[model samples]
Target: MRILILTHRVPFPQNGGYPIVVGNTIKGLVSMGHEVSLISINVKKHSGRQHERDDLLNKISYTEYGIDTHISVLEVFSNLFTRNPYNINKYYDAGFEKLVLQNIKDNHYDVVQLEGLFVGPYVAAIRKNTTAKLIYRAHNIEHQVWHRLAHQKNDPFKKWYLNLLARRVKKYELELLNQFDGIAVFTGEDKNAMESFGAEIPLCVVPIGVDMGKYQPEPDKTECPSLFFLGSLDWLPNREGIEWFIENFHKEIVDGDLKVKFYVAGNSIPEDFDEYDVPDKVFIQGEVDDALEFVNSKSIMIVPLLSGGGMRVKIVEGMAMKKCIISTTIGAEGINFAHGDNIIIANNAGEFYDALKRCIADEWYCREIGENARKLVEQEHDVNKVTRDLVAFYQSVI
Candidate 1:
């Protein structure tokens, strides 16, 4: 099968969530003897280094068009008058659309998969240009993220604006539903969300998969009674989650009897992050060289996400690395895990604190949880197995 994947950014480097999933999917499909081509709109932030981009080019057929997605005050104000979603509208480039059309006309593809909702605008062009089965691989229900963000906002005006943005994005999302031949979501929850929004088209769950071979568990290196949170801080949900955790539970944990430490590591750590008067035990190590190494060093992985949609790839990676994970219900969504068996689900600060306490007090319990997590990943998220299922779905859609 010949597959074409369209994404808003280059999936090389795999430094962040979006790239990791997209890059792994491409690799998995190629390993299964399927021809894969990628058309990506590269922004400055996600363009990655020259060597990283070269590495990707060596592996698969990829074409990237550079675009400026920087948000400006003028664009924001102007978008208020239009019903179109500012976030999705900014990604619509005439040149990129022309390039997509030309690619479709030149190469006969069995399936053209839009990697996320941002690329949904290009569906009409692809539908008209080719007879290929169009698949929308939804990473999340885009508008729900905003709706959750809106609910979290305290200011009335900000909340109103966020709700408005969510509505506009929702309208655009629902409008694009039937335009695709099939829809692939990261979770069953996402599929249900789409169905409730009147998406009558074929929908299937395709959770994010990782190459387990790349992740080797180093249990000996694990630091007992230590906790760490890893993710891109530039993303609202991650930053919000970390902030919420610190504001609500950090002091309690620090002042408690246990001498446990919390380490925060990720890309794009905010400038004002240091301004917070956090305890000395809470170490902020922003943007480490090797993510797996960082995960291996930690005893317990914490995901205190208050609001977000879709699956958290970091959770899957941590599980693959055999780290005991304690996350909120929202954080662990889309994953097939029992609350106490494979993972620890904590919805509020009290629950998170209790879970952290339990993990710190008993080293053996943490090890047991970590082992179960690794087993879950092996059984459910192996990249080869996931790609085979994806290919079967493509065949059914075709």
Candidate 2:
């Protein structure tokens, strides 16, 4: 089958879960001998000087890691006039869809994979022109993430406006789902979440996979009892997760008798955002390029996410790295694993503190739990197995 996949980000480098999922999915499809072409949406948040901008313009933009890569970077003109959030501008088009339409007409693919709801509008018209099947990969309920941000924001006017905008966008996003032939969700819970939002489309679950070889527990243990939190901080949930960790976990653990340094690292932290202290116990090393290496270097991975959709792929990554997890119940959601078995879950400050202590001091327990967790990821989230299942789902839909 000849498939055309569209994504909201460059899926190479796999710094964030969305890219990791899309990049690996393309690999799986290509391995099955299906001809795949990718059209990744590049929403570049330029943090550069005028000379740097000129340099960026000259930089070689190459085809990323899909089978037959077709990259198209998009920029918005209205962005000059509008100060809308990344959650909005990331999906906003600057005529890339026209090129996509032209390409679709020329190639006439067997299937068109839409990566997220943000790209829904672009592909809605693609269906009208072609006889190809459309697979809408809803990474998460996009509106819910915005809603969480609205609630978390202290500024009343901003919170109210964000919430209102989310409600409006969600209605549109929900309507767009019906435009596609099949909708794929990260978790069963997400599929159900969509249904609760009145999504009537045919939906299936495609769980994210772990590259077991790269992430699985190594023979050598980490040197220090360091707690780690990793994700692309540009995402609201990751920021919230770490922010919550600092407020809740850092407060209780910083002055405590236990001596464990905490590392908060991820990708693409905006400079305007505060990179402050958590009582000298926490180091906010925002956006580490190599996540698994960072995860392995830590004794425990702490996830204090309050609200978000879909599975925590990082938790699975941490599990693969044999780092005992200290996460909120919400943070640990969607991965088909039990609390005490594969990970250690905590809801609040006290419980998180306790989980951290257990992971820090108890070497034997850590080894056993970490080993078991690694095994669980291998059994349940092996990339090859999950990819096969995803292929089966696509085959069924086709």
After superposing candidate 2, which stretches have Cα over 4 Å from the reference? 46-90, 219-221, 251-253, 270-280
Worst 10 residues of 2 by lDDT: 48-57
What TM-score number comes out for model 1?
A: 0.96
Candidate 1 segments whose C-alpha is farther than 4 A from its true place: 48-56, 253-258, 276-280
Best by TM-score: 1
Candidate 1 displacement at residue 43 in angstroms: 1.0
Model 2 compared with the native: what TM-score?
Answer: 0.85
Q: Estimate each model's TM-score.
A: 0.96, 0.85
lDDT of 1 by residue, 123-182 (tens): 888899999999999999889999998998899999999999999998998899989999
Model 2: per-residue lDDT, tens digit, 238-309?
877677666655555567655788777777765643444465576778766467777777777777887787
